[model samples]
Target chain A: MTTRILTPEELALLSLVQDELVPSYGDLPPAGTLGAALTVDAYLAEQPRLRRPVLTTLRAIEVRAGKAPFAELDAGRRVEVLRKVENADPESFSELVKQTYNAYYTRPDIQASLGIDNPPQPLGFELPAFDESRLSRVRAMGKLWRDD
Target chain B: MAAPELDSDVLIVGSGASGAAAAWSLSRGGLRVTCLEQGRWVDPSEYAHSRPDYELARQTSFAKDPNVRGWAADYPINNSGTPIYPLMVNAVGGSTVHWSGHFPRMRPSDFRVRTLDGVADDWPFTYWDLEPYYDLNDSMVGVSGLAGDPANPPRSPRQTPPLAFDAGCEAYLRGLENLGWHWWPCDNALISEPFGENRSPCNCCGPCDIGCPIGAMSSAHVTYWPKALAQGVQLITHARVEQITVDHAGQATGALYYDDHGVRRSHTAGVVVMAANGVGTPRLLLNSTSARFPNGLANNSGVVGAYLMFHPVAFVSGVFEEVVNGQRGPIGGLMNCQEFYETDLARGFVRGFELQLSRSVGPLSVANGGILGHPVPWGSEHHEALRSRYAHTMTTSVMLEDLPEPENRVTLDPELTDAHGIPAPRVEYRAGENTQRMLEFSIARARELFEAAGAVEILVDPLVQESGWHLMGTCRMGDDPERSVINGWGQAHECSNLFVIDGSTFTTSAAVNPTSTIQAVALRCADWLGRNYRDVAA
Candidate 1:
């Protein structure tokens, strides 16, 4: 609910990593295009406990890339750095991955494109009513359990 | 911090499935009833399913794990070194607030586990003793199912028709038919038709576990609590129970709990019922120590925190080549196969597993790898992987019936404490040899079912953390007062006025969802109390 929990520098670094994580695919833009970094930053403000670990992860990845803030690193070099960070501290890295994906995919436009009517409430989907015919074969073999 | 005493004839702690049922029955029977729930009431409008950030909300606000969500009402549970982390909510409806409403009654043989399978203690009462209660609870909860399946005993017709099967469930049903195995459209605690004034009919919203805003799912708040409140049952919300106080005779007087304003208060009731599920019940019992009962109230049998059981689940997801909508219908299960439900000596295990069909996957779940434990790879293959697994995958929670072991238990953590400084429950559990073997056997069989359904590829995460929803056997019930903590009627062996009407009193953990059975047991206990409160109270 708070505005701009992350610094511009931090947001820049996070967007680069988010882009690297999901990249771009066809007409669907990458995670960065869908504002994953901003969403994650806003979420971190809500869940204050997660903010430190996420920032620590970003700084660690920056250190791993050497002389670069991980944002300036080439695509090839960035992948190497991310893999190394993932191996070194899996919990933080995995949490970052989880949050990134969560932010990217739950966006209304993304869900709409994925054939989901957004906000699956008030009005929901429909399917066939329960048909008794489906149980014809199984019911034919009467009563498998021995007890009443 | 002591506050004024409140008036009540019966005080029940925890307003989950069992607690709600007990409240309704006891209050209807004309007894003064009051329930203390640690968490506040949740309005249907606040449910995550209605928001665009629904999946993210599941990780944060609506998380099943208390440690992850870290709300004020929740007490920290130390689940260190346990493969299956316990998942529960502390709100008015308790865990049922975010439940799948997958209602499966324990079979007749489940009660006589020791006599038939030659392991674990048999329940003091038989399935026949509890059958009427089960039928009553089913009617009250408005269970949706088809009768005469032949896998279990014939029963009264279900209240409503079975939930509609999605494409993924239909595919699984086809697999069962192809293999000539026994299968049934699952019984769910869901209202297919509009039964309650508050709840809407099922529209197959596909996110019942995310907290149903429409109230089609039979959560206790919507189903039992409404009637219980209407019948003049006084339910106290945000009342975190700290200890179960006792009289000089070691008989139950009432409970001392921290009220909403963090003020200590005492409520005196003639009878006290511990309806705070398996883990929560034991934690409270162990934390409550007094001069009359050194080891803890009603814990003289030394089985107060023993024989803890969790149906260790092995999650298997199948990716089919054919079109299947995994994101429609009830996500918990539309079909469940009990082919290996009965214990066969040849299977190399004393107990078996029930393969529950679940195919609901959201975009966020798919991107984050869901329960299958394989995050869709990033970069070039990300979109393709997402599309392939989105609606085309179906899952089965291979629920293994973990036999009760004395070593597997819930103990009070000396170092860890809740906000009120009450000791937190430390769970010490490892899947025993029997459960491990059963998993190996059941996982292989589950693969066959998926294969028959034309799954191009299959994924298995042998054990998932969120599968620890079924908590039982921390305070066992039996005929022998020396062996069990509670008696057949769920009355504490040492304390006549104290009753345990939750999964904690289960003698054995059956290989099915225990909500239906838990409520049935609660109903039976409340019915007994209503008819004989004077005798029991004396």
Candidate 2:
């Protein structure tokens, strides 16, 4: 498929949301893949009939992008929004911005397409190739996330 | 969410051994059975062909997104920080997709562990009561083992030969004999030779914990699911049951659930079987609050989510000179030391434990744990430790039987909810004194076994997180309705048409794995339904 150049409005808004989500994102689009980050296919698979919720989540992110120059925001502000809207719900405008950013970048299909085999392991972590030093470090980092 | 309209003769929840067996039996009995599974059907060939991949799936891979449900996060069972816990499979086959296939029957003593030992409550039925169904399940699944052992209850001859043991098994035998402990080859569900069914002989790929790629392990996927499907069982996957609606008269009419599309759907059936597993089943029942039964569905005895138990596991490993080749066969191999299965007068623990002489470490597991006495930082020392431990390590797992304490229960957290906004099951559990004492005894025995095997260095996993894996007793079966959730026949005490045929019905946590017994009970329950309700049609 031919790469379509995003409209100026789309480009600016996408860049703002990307910056809000992942502050370190460079010149490229915020998504892990160059294409649309949140596809209808993936959304429908989990949320089936929740198109309104999806749209609402996306629109909130867009609204933040519409007002603020998200890319120019400080790292702390970017993180604030990201944490807020990380889920399908946005607790704040900053969260909306962050959620939109993450939603765009964290697409499974996009990651696969990008040949990025890096997926989060269960219990919020991953076991990489067996390296004694790394394993010891992680083991020593005991109870980083408390079950309580 | 609104409840969708659904109509069926029989609606079976879950897809594990009991669920699958019930579906198979019910479908064969000519009922229009609709089986609802929260997990999709995983093609074993696609995901679990190689040993490396299988290990990866078990040790590392997250469950598929849709299969990863709310209960996992809501109830934190594995507080040990390890990712592993009482992992319920979401796909059509359920946990049977990844079981060790050690299908031992509940010994005659096992049924009455409570009465004989004076610890817990006795099962309403006896071994003879469940023997025919055990025989049926064993025959249908092609159980393999040596049957002459006097330790276990007498049964019909195994349909297939026993699985071959490794050098580690030989050492275990010698060590156990030295300790004067009786050992018998495990009665597993694997076919040792070409059998009457579609199953093939065991190639011994040791990755049965994740799943058996080939047709070696007799999972419900190969055993009953296909048969059920062929008999016209309508299976709907990715369906998460939320509530069971009952009439004013207290008879179950149907259930409300989330379909694959996350759309609220409802299914009405003449009979509803809750096989959603110990945690899921109780959670659903507790969440199904109507004006008539506000506490939960069929919880008139106020015991829908009480008396939970799990086998407390303690691991001990030692480094040997020889290569054990642990990644070659079934996850559990050789014999189990059942000397501790029954309570001993000299023992501190009221209940007992079973020493499963299972396989040693695979290369990957050894690599993960640096060699014994070599806890160096992860550079050169780490590599050396992995190399030293890779071939020399052997492990023995102690499955300590837990007593069903009323305090150890499954309840719904008022604050927490699943992705679909349904209340999540909150688990409140603590290891009873009997289990802790059993662990202490097993730890001591494990140390002795390692020394007997001439191990240079032995390492035992610190007892930390207690799991709810062998989940049972949520809806226990007994003679009195006031005491138990289900009747002796596995039917709900309040609702006759509703049956609970999973680990939830276990009255006591026997030292043996409960999957096989659960399957037997499920098959028997199905037979009862068939003989009783033959006139019901699709």
DockQ top scorer: 1
Lowest summed lDDT window (length 10), candidate 2 chain A: A121-130
lDDT of 1 at B332: 84
lDDT of 2 by residue, B448-526 (tens): 9878878777887745242335778899998888889988767888777678889999998787788889998898788
Return the interface RMSD of the candidates, in order shown, one decimal each.
Answer: 1.6, 18.5
Best by lDDT: 1
Q: Which regions in candidate 2 have their CA more than 4 angstroms from the true location?
A: A1-148, B1-6, B48-54, B62-84, B196-198, B370-377, B464-467, B534-538
Stretches of candidate 1 exceeding 4 Å from the true structure: A1-3, B1-6
Candidate 2's displacement at residue B1, Å, is 31
TM-score of each: 0.97, 0.74
Tens-place lDDT per residue, model 1, B485-504, is 99889999899999999999
Error of 2 at B28 (Å): 2.1
